[model samples]
Target: MDEKKPSRMYFIGKKEDLIQAKRTTVTLDGRDILLLYHQRTFYAMDLQCYHAGSTLETGDMEEINSKLCIVCPKHKYKITLAEGEGLYKATNPTEKVPTPRWYSKGIKQRVHKVTEVDEDIFVSVSTCPVWIESDYYQSEKGRAELKKAQESGDAEADVNADEDV
Candidate 1:
């Protein structure tokens, strides 16, 4: 949390900048992390939507199932702020009491730890292997392949592409 960066922690930017913008994307150790400020708390997660790689920095915020969540602008996938849990409501209109049930996709998105120090902020990428699912969070090769696939009209390729080493 201090000016002396820790072994894992990486300096992101000034806290004042985040306070003004509300949301930002920072490249830490190679990953694009989305840092959000909502209700006086800081939330950090993958910068792109886990479902389809849409930029989450442009997403909207709302409360879902008593938890703060970011609604993906592209597909409206609601992801919890505190934890990277994916939320979805199961619609079963044929039940005795027709209602929707919320379920977790088991942390489809990756999140990191954030620390604040005076006017500065730092982030440490999660050690969980879940982040490896991202096309190229750790390198540019996966990103280039993803971009090439996207440009070639191969929508399914992105889903099957391997992570960059």
Candidate 2:
């Protein structure tokens, strides 16, 4: 099977700075994103848990059945790295999980597309939580504004470096 690639990249941080099993939360374009690194793979998801809207940044990272899963701190719901369906089962195994005749899949969380370039972590803007309703970057004006902000941030970093010298 061929692996899927991210459509776009948004810089997160240096690869060396990310620690395994540590959750990082970042808000970009008014959308909250949760980042988790485990076994050299970076998983990106919405900050809100599917179960009860709990912040997944505070969830517990665990390795279950050789798969990386996040246990929601509020209800102990577990979500897997590949697919986010293990939560319901882990939390309530005694109850019969309802499923439609057409589909038997359990509750699943949306996983954002992530990519790493060199040492920098990037996430696809299309998969960003904010763009779910309507893509904020679809308009040329929005793209231009984002570009300007990135350029300004770069210039500011350069100025700071010069001041330190």
Candidate 3:
């Protein structure tokens, strides 16, 4: 006897709207997501880019080598809409950091589920938390102290007081 596999379902977009357009944006549980229709199949992924948290819904779409591609507006991270690949690349020290390394280190990679029912489409509502290492924790503490000092305006005063009159 074969074991039955668990079925998953998510609501993405109206079938009519998807039929008219290749892509659509839907908000589920306060999380922004994008629905892509290709070859009569649906794919869903987080709207925010892993690189810079830019909304993929507002990003441009292109067809490369017969595959649909989504480009991040903030960093131009190219992702294939068909299989949801290239969404997140591993962090390398050689790569330029747009944001603080600590915050960037906490950016986790994710792949969401996509499903279609009748005329509507849906994506699974789930997010995975990134684990912070010792360096990340220490960096966060330093940043918090710097932020507090800046907010209090004490850091600026100390810097000016050190300058020659």
Most accurate candidate by TM-score? 1
Error of 1 at 86 (Å): 0.5
Write out the backbone clash pairs for model 1.
none
- The alpha-carbon deviation from the true structure for residue 24 of candidate 3, after best TM-score superposition, in angstroms, is 2.3
Clashes of 1: 0
| Candidate with the greatest lDDT versus the true structure | 1
**What's the CA RMSD for each of the models?**
5.9, 13.9, 12.3
Error of 2 at 2 (Å): 23
- Cα lDDT, model 1, residue 127: 72
lDDT of each: 0.74, 0.58, 0.53
After the best TM-score superposition of candidate 2, give how far the Cα of residue 93 lies from its true spot, in angstroms: 11
| TM-score of every prediction relative to native | 0.78, 0.58, 0.49
- Rank order (by lDDT, best first): 1, 2, 3
TM-score of candidate 1 versus the correct structure, residues matched by position = 0.78
For model 3, name the residue pairs that clash: 10-122, 11-121, 11-122, 12-121, 12-122, 13-121, 15-119
Candidate 1 vs 3: which has more TM-score: 1
Taking the tens digit of each residue's C-alpha lDDT, what string does model 2 give over 1-165? 113533556788887786643668876645567888877788887666554344578777887656678886756667776665543332344558853222213435656677888878887633423322112222454345445646777311111122210
Clashes of 2: 0
